[model samples]
Target: MTETVRIATLDGADSFDAYVAWPEGTPRAAIIVIQEIFGVNPGIRAKCDKWAAAGYLAVAPDLFWRIERGIELDPDVEPEMQRAFELFGLNKPDDNVKDIEATIHWIRREAGVPKVGAVGYCLGGKLAYMTATRTDIDASVGYYGVMIDQMLGESHAIAKPLLLHVPTADHFVDAEAQAKMHEGLDGHPRVTIHDYEGLDHGFATESGNRRDEAGAQLADSRTAEFFAANL
Candidate 1:
């Protein structure tokens, strides 16, 4: 089953919408589906339903609600892509992370779900990494998370398991950044970085031209396995 829900922020003055999906029976765990630059659009909601099919309750929050009530962009459209970048530039990720924290707390307190994990793509991917380091999320998966090399200092706080999918050919994250990420996090016991040779960003998206079937399946299987083991 799928439904729309409202999540309360920590400050109590703000509340945002979230799209939720549930399995037929009791969920084994709860998975927070973080959105990319696009808001909780069809692709993101589809991901939540996919997790539901896998016996995990899933929710996708509208993190962009801070800047705009609803934002759904198409990567293939030039204008939308420009808007997405603009939204990305204007987005306050730190504040959005707090919304994720609130969502985690909501799942635990209201839904009675003790184990909660998160998976994200694009900008969501970066947030997932931040979630791992900042919050008590049980497990986190980031697919081609951008700008992660810039935040290696906080890696020390990552107590739970984190799976990062790195596309070696990602233009957004060049060789130097990837090298820096590896140098800082490769040996960390709680972190695992999987490199997809010759692939680029968005290869694991649920739909669109960016989706590479083989690469998506490989990365997704790894994500599923990682969540199963850790969450």
Candidate 2:
């Protein structure tokens, strides 16, 4: 089951319209699922439900709520991509961090789970990195995160366990950039980076044409293992 909820931001504003999903009994952990540029669409919500089914209390906050409420995108459309980018371009990374922090606080306070972890996709993957830096999450998983190199420059602030899933063929993230990200995280013993071959951005979403069944299965298995180990 799922319910729409609101969370208060650090700046004393209503920051998100989020969905909470869990079973009837107590949860093992609370998970914060961040959305891609498309906002909190059906795919992300499904992911939250999957986590809930796996015995977690899952919450997916609408990160793009600052720009517009209930904005959703068709993953295959160029126009929708443009609109999503336009909305995301309006906010700075610091703003996203604040919003994410607020979401974390909401989960910790309201979800009633003793431990918390995070998972994110696309733009959310970057936010997962940011969440590790700013929040007290036990674990985090990022799927096909862009701008990881930019986040690596501040790796000193990250201390939690992080799993970054990258696609070999993703245009936004090339081999050289991935190498830099690995090098920057050299001393971070808690970080694990995995590269999935023959996959592109949004490979975990079944609705996307580039979705690779094998790669998605491997990633999902590893992600669940990572959370189990850390959370």
Give the whole-model CA lDDT for all candidates, comma-separated: 0.94, 0.83
Model 1 quality (TM-score): 0.99
TM-score for each of the candidates: 0.99, 0.95
Model 1, C-alpha of 57: deviation from truth (Å): 0.4
Maximum-lDDT candidate: 1
**Candidate 1 — worst ten consecutive residues by lDDT sum?**
69-78
TM-score between candidate 2 and the true structure: 0.95
Question: RMSD in angstroms, all models?
Answer: 0.6, 1.4
lDDT of 2 by residue, 131-205 (tens): 888877888998998898987866777788999998988887888887888788756887888888767888887
**Candidate 1 on 132-170: residue-level lDDT in tens?**
999999999999999999999999999999999999999
